[model samples]
Target: MSLTHLPSLHRPASHGAGVRHKAQSMLHWGLSQGLPNVVVKMAARKGDLQGLLTQAGSGDEIWEVIDQVRAQGPLVKGRVTFITADHAVVSEVLTSKAFRTGNPLDRLGFLATASIRLRPDTMHPLVEPSLLVTEPPDHTRYRKLVTRVFTMRAVEKLRDRAETVARELLDELEGRVDLVEQYCSLLPVTLISQILGIPTSERRNVLAMGSDIAASLDFGLSWPEYRDVDAGLRRFDAWQEAHIETLRKNPGDDLLSQLVHVQDEDGTLDMAELKATAGLVLAAGFETTVNLLGNGIKLLHDNPEELSKLQQDPALWPNAVEEVLRIDPPVLLTARFAPEPTTLEGQYISAGLQVVVLLAGANRDPHVFEDPTRFDVTRANARDHLSFSAGRHHCLGAALARMEGEVGLKSFFDRYPDVTLLPGAQRRPTRILRGWRTLPAQV
Candidate 1:
């Protein structure tokens, strides 16, 4: 349906009376481990000018678990508290102006709690904690260097190689193969390794280790799990440091070498910044694209007509990719720190108090996205989705991701025009990134 014809959240449900009632609100849920947490409701539920969202206190695992508990509720009309900003907050958070203000991620605490939930650590225990999770100056310095190498110019050059990677992976698929494991997961990792000059032999080991570290942030890990993740980080860092050392003496064409050797007259990146940038690019490039391809394919499975349209005219692949990212983004919500006591949505977020912006919720805000829930490929603003985030923290690898998705999807349909989802396509267990750890489908 056209966005204008799409139903609003408040529109009476097509179902029988009483079926349209919203889900439970101001949820009070608890974690099995310890304390209890209460979710504050957001004014976005009511489409207020100021986006007011309720957040559970970060007192302990209780809050983290509470968010996890809330994540389980219906994706639509989930019980919510005003602590987190709702759709009322999308324009501010996702607009380019937000980033130009400088250090938007840290300034707003975009989704710190979510980050904490993913990996509850006082310090950044993970290697190269995303610029999304870091403060500016701290984030900006490194981000600048990474962008230079990962720019559209550079990423476009890798298109053919990415296609080869996709093709080679698809050729190896067998009956009921996990599209994610065999195709999606493996493709980006290998691609990133190639970009960074890492050998293919180490891709699996690095990816597994990366997964362990990334997984520690979700569902709240135990002390031992945390330690194990930390250990894995050390190993990855040590290995990267060694590799970086090798490049310093004998630089190559890989992305890492570019960062190491590329210099502005003023000197743009430092060693620490270099390592952090390289690590983040490799991890984010691989992980985000992996989820994007898997999710895009899954979306095709869900919307066959859309798939058919794309199959008929691969040109739609670009728009289809945008629609997919918007509708089913890999990263859902992000937490930002309030740099100062700011008033938004008629609510005061005190300085240092963390504010998490629900991108998933904001993307579905009827005001910005006409019929925010209904999936529409031709929607003029479908690309406006916060999947890449906006402002200073907009995804650095977005261009690369887009090119990869466009090429990956186009190549897939060209190769197997009749491809269809198997009876079941696995979904990633966590809510942070929406994807399949395993997708068993046949062409």
Candidate 2:
């Protein structure tokens, strides 16, 4: 549980010309062997996540990178030798039964595990595995305990409440407001908090702690930031543990309570499993949904023609949501490791190596959609994008997120047909998750 050995955010200084030569050599190897895409190579040398984020901010650049990699082949080595990114290859890798989540021994080592604090119970509580990190049959077992509850039917039951929460939050907006703070961000956390049965009074604490914990997924962090994150996680765990106890004594219809009371024909989840599951649900339920709403709104604003189309026909809200997701998904990247040596798109992938799938990039692959970069709400196949990911690890709350987005966006335009994006909207700097930090809007 100690954070004594946390890694620094910046990439360490290389040891003179020898290291520089080695990096150059790696870059050459990538190009010569048709390994990584050009952007990945540039990112590797810089060791700058900010630069990479900036590069991906434009859809055309992302598709260009994906196209460049596709030309080389379906699979190519990434900026890091151990990583790879290919649009077609990534799609296959995500769905293939051969690939799995988590690589036991990665370059980041303990620093990576400690950085996130996945397991908070062991001597190395930082290495704890949640649903996102576990491989089957462990993943299967853990996922099974909650899968039924996340089913479309189960989540649909919350649609009315989700809509109510969104409408009420938007109804309070006056003239100009920071949509990210006032509406998009508040709605998801408020909705998830209610679902977890966290008291209305304590939801602010939950949101703060959840934000801190969620930042752990960003990976690169300075010691001071990690210290703050570590402290926040400890507080979060303490609160969740106490809440779990309360649920045990006074179970309700909430998801957390259901998790607490769930018993299978084979057995039941242990306390550690319960906390891990609940923590993932709490964090995942809101973090991505907030981004989905913020990102979707931004996309709409950037494309006034598309926004007009939606304004003209409110029924297009559902399809518009999918297009928004396609153009700008909340989750930008996801990775999977080869549990066993396998071949993808005729390229040999070694066991334990990782393939970092650029979900947003894949969504814009030219082969999949016409005029890939255009934000067209009527695009019939927009739903096929990998925004929610695919296969065993596809987002469990996707249905709920979609419904919330549909209701939120549709209702917002209905109430304020003249809403427009204010200048100076700011985007969050985090590397893994993409969303606005301060998206100002005027009604």
Candidate 3:
């Protein structure tokens, strides 16, 4: 059915209902008002977004669901109202000036407490106004300062360093290891720690804390995971405070020190801003890159033909990496908000509404790429994928990520040309990130 044919319902002028009821009513009404007919039909058969997510226990199932939504049109409605599985629509939504990466805590009629329930640290000022949750002047200002230190030049300066670290880590590996833990996870964390100038004595603790913080990026977490995330933030905050004082008193040549000393006409970053910036870089730098390396190896292992092609012509490794990213992106879901009432692909999106963009779906849309599901390392348009997102909020660490993925994967295969993945590899159980949790393999 077309978007205009969506059912009309009486919307409450005032959301006086309690949080739970208000959210349920708002979600149901949004579906009726803005959801695609296909989504409504699916909900009738398998319940709503939550049910669908529960049923999609594997990556393949999630891809199938996304394909179904794409078949209906460019857009559908999930619980967050406007959702798109189409590649073109996802690009348009991400790049449009009218749309903003508004605060998720304030959108979708979901209580701020809901986010708190996921990870209580979001309520703290030290994490709340960071680039991840900002718009306009704030994002513009913060990104400008960061760009000075996080430039392509800066990343290039570390390329040789990262390559050295990758080689060293691979050398330390034994006959058999969980690649996820031994190499894939360790190399990135170690490289990022070095770049951030984290104390050598505190690197292990900081790595653990960073992992918990990264896990908290998922839509929600288990009770145990939540506690771990909360505790991680507390420890992370304390570390940042001590380091901030240290960097302030005796500046060094590290990113954290640069961030500490960075100043503009509006003075330097405040204490909270400093903490938030450091936390953001540390968390964002390592998390997704680990997935990229893990996911790339896993995909290549599953497709021997593609792997052989890369092994034969090492020049294809860069393109292979792009195809890997296109096939299995790291971050799965991102949202944008309509600052004013607008029409998206002919569907009405009210002001202050959340529109969830599924990057994995867009990467596989048949409308954009021929044989979208096939794992072809030689795919020419592979770089067209939105794995690092788009527009102003496009990932700041993208160049660094690409460099790491290339170096890390190449060095590993060179070290163990005949390495094979063991059975029983496990995937992370989270809505936002998509990659292996444990990938045992033998050299």
TM-score per candidate, chains pooled: 0.73, 0.82, 0.84
Q: Which candidate model has the greater TM-score, 2 or 3?
A: 3
lDDT of each: 0.61, 0.71, 0.74
lDDT by residue for model 1 (1-443), tens: 42112243245556523222211010100221112112222343443212222221111222243344234331212222223324546446444222222123233342432232333222232324456556566666667667765688888888989989888877876656667777777877887888888877888988886776664344334445445655666677677778888888988888788888878655856666666677778767877788888888877777788877776776677888899887777776565445566655556555555445566665665667787667766778888778877777788888888888888777776776666677666565443555667777776
What total of clashing residue pairs does each candidate reach? Answer: 32, 3, 0
Per-residue error for 311 in candidate 3, Å, reads: 2.3
lDDT of 2 by residue, 26-108 (tens): 33233322222355447745853323433554333454555555555545665443323445666787888888776434434
Q: By the TM-score metric, which is better: model 1 or model 3?
A: 3
lDDT for position 376 in model 3: 97
Ranking by TM-score: 3, 2, 1
Worst 10 residues of 3 by lDDT: 1-10
lDDT score for residue 309 of model 3: 86
Off by over 4 Å in 3: 1-46, 49-51, 54-58, 104-127
Ranking by lDDT: 3, 2, 1
